[model samples]
Target: MKHLTILVPDAQTSLNTFACIIGAYDIFTRANQHWVGQGKDPVFTVCLAGVSENAVIQQDIMSIRPEFRLSQVAGTNLILIPAISLDFERPEGGNIELTGWIREQYNKGAEVASMCSGGLMLASTGLLDGKSCSIHWNAVDKLKNLFPRVLVKTERLITDAEGIYTNGGGYSFLNLVLYLVEKYYNRETAIYCSKIYQIEIDRQNQSAFTIFTGQKAHGDEVIRKAQAFIEDHFREKISVQDLSTRFAVGRRNFDRRFIKATGNTPVEYVQRVKVESAKKSLESTRKTISEVMYEVGYADVKAFREVFRRITGMSPLEYKNKYNKEGADLAAMS
Candidate 1:
């Protein structure tokens, strides 16, 4: 049987963290039960392991006591890290011992997976260094700033590189668990759990859910000015050459500085700003996709659709149908 340890973090955590822990345990255990019901032996030995005997969460609203402390588990086949509160300034959240233990387990040939913001803890262990990791979109900028060595894939729902798995924000972690279930057990078992939990299987991207708030925390006055200008005039046909000239900087020099400060090229920043504005219009107004596109300064329908899909993983019409209740109702009526 594969030994699967769900880590109960030794830090103040959100209700989301509690849900991930309980949810993972319930799903994996149920997978075993399902196998047993089929007259087959259990596939996993699941346990809740922790650095401390009990960890209080969410201002002591609840406490979790692990089945075994980290010290007690000399080794395991798999270690799952649940989401904990992420202080971007201190991504580790003072869980030094926990990170160390995780690194040790991983070095001992155990697979590690982190759910949502739990990628912060997993990244802290240095296991994700030079590896692709999926994290909550909200934390992408912070993760990039803190762990420059780690390749952060904000659009991906799940990233599996060398046995270290990570998933995107919130309840999307359920999808990652389903993926592991399929890998560790069988596709049939994963499908059974997915049905029981009502989780959509094979969800590959979280880009549709991301709200692109441009990164502006850097210490570059010129770049900040450029960003504000783009945001303020996203509806205008703003070109990089125009921006560079207006800012009194050479084109190549401006491009280098913009990318260094904002992690986006000048053209990408302009596209993101325009797309973000288009998204809001589609969500709140009774505008057609073409109207929204034109309002955001895109005259070409095909080009607008391409950029929208590239950034959001959904077409403008699809995004509207998903987020605009009135639009969805109108479509249903039609």
Candidate 2:
């Protein structure tokens, strides 16, 4: 039997999708565990994750006989997130801690995935960047608005961008868990698991943008070079011909596989990184808009401003104004 753990601010708290995974995964003949009263007994855990329950459960976990720390996290094979904190508008506090642990597990070969807004936490950690990822539609605006580096998309169930898969909401969690079971055990096991959970397995065809087979192979020499090019010249004008020549593939072939795997055309993806870098510059430096534009490889202020507004829905000046105001508030407190 496989192990699945759900993390939560409180065990008493309930988020819809997280709770559903627990009930859904059990049908795969897998045992499960949850963090309760602030104590996660890693000794008996196979998975580690959060819950979608109410804060009362969170209070219960906080009041655990001992205390909660990521002790059992090492034993976790899979991680599941029910939903995210409602009170915390962004992925902060315990949520960040949880994402960090998942990242740790992912590095060590453990499978990590999430449902609904949980993708925000996964994405925020840079875990889902350079990969296919998705989140709830309502939350997508804020996600793209903030994380320009990630290829955020819309999906009804799960988008498996490489190994990091995310769903649209809680009910989608059931599909993901069942899919996970199918991956490890067998299609039959997933069927039995779904049967036990009384969940549907036949989801309609989803976008090519959502699911990924997994990250590029462990040691793909070609992809490594492409990655380097993307980092060094992302802000510059990079053509598919440029990338294809390096990979020794024709431009057409290169574009298809790159988009199929990365969820964006070469230009769209690089622009995303440049936009992200611009955001950082806007937040941290006092460079004028023109300097910032050239710094990010765009010489035309009008063009850059238009693209920035289109993606983030705000002028660069507006972004700086908002960012500066927040910084000022923090400085005054200090």
Candidate 3:
């Protein structure tokens, strides 16, 4: 049997982490049971490994038991790190032991997968340096700020490179586990699990659900002003040159500061702001796609559609149909 070690963080406690740990274990164990029901042998031997023997959470209201500690396990075929506490600013304290074990496992040819913010812990191992990862969209900026070498993408729901894998926000870990189910077991088995769990299979991107709130916590005063200007005048044709002139900063320096502070270039930031505004209008108002696009300062049909799809992974109409109540009702009828 292939060994699957699900690594639970010792001190970290959160509902998402709890769900991921139990969710992963349930799916893997159920996959084995499904195999046995089909008169076939089990494929995986799953273990819950952690730094401590037990972890208490929710003010000691709940506790988790682990099957093995770091020192007890020699090696394993795979490591699944669940989401941890959202305290992204948690200083590098005693967790060197956990991150070090993760790196050592990867070096020994074990594949590692992190769920949601679990990517933060995996990133501590320096294994994510020069690698692409997907984390919760809300935490993308923070993760990028903390680990500059890691390429964090909010568009994708899952990312897999080398021996490392990651997923986007919340309970999307279910989709990632389903992906592994297809990889290790078979497409049919994964479909079976999908049916049983009521999870939509083959979801590749989280962009459709994104709500863009530009990063404003950076200390760059000029860039913050530029961002505010962009938000205020998104309905107008506000160019970068216009912003530079209005802010009395050099064009090149302004661009550098904007990107550094917001993780998006001036033009990209403007487009995102406009799209975000358009999203709100589409959701709450009965504006047609053209009206929404025009209100957001885009006159060209093709240009608006391209930018919307690039950032959101869907056309304006698709987004509207998904989010707007009337559109959803129409879709349900047809």
lDDT of candidates 1 onward, in order: 0.88, 0.60, 0.88
TM-score for predicted model 3 compared with the true structure: 0.95
> Which one wins on TM-score?
1
lDDT of 1 by residue, 13-57 (tens): 777789899999999999999999999989889999877665544
Better of 2 and 3 by lDDT: 3
Candidate 1 CA-lDDT value: 0.88
Alpha-carbon runs more than 4 Å astray in model 1: 58-60, 88-94
Specify the highest-lDDT model's number: 1
Which residue pairs of candidate 1 clash? Answer: none
TM-score head-to-head 1 vs 3, winner: 1
Candidate 2, residue 243: lDDT: 90
Alpha carbon lDDT at 15, candidate 2: 48
Tens digit of lDDT per residue, candidate 2, span 1-334? Answer: 3455555543212445335444544543341222122243322234333422222233322321112346544556666665664333445545556667778878876666777677766776778777766675555655665576777665445677556767766466677777776676557656765676687885632331232222333354565567568877877777778899978988887777766555557776676667767877887887777888999999888889887765555688877776766655665688
Candidate 1 similarity to native, TM-score: 0.96
Q: Rate residue 310 of model 1 by lDDT.
A: 97
Instruction: Give me the displacement of residue 169 in model 2, in angstroms.
Output: 1.7
For candidate 3, give the lDDT of residue 32.
87
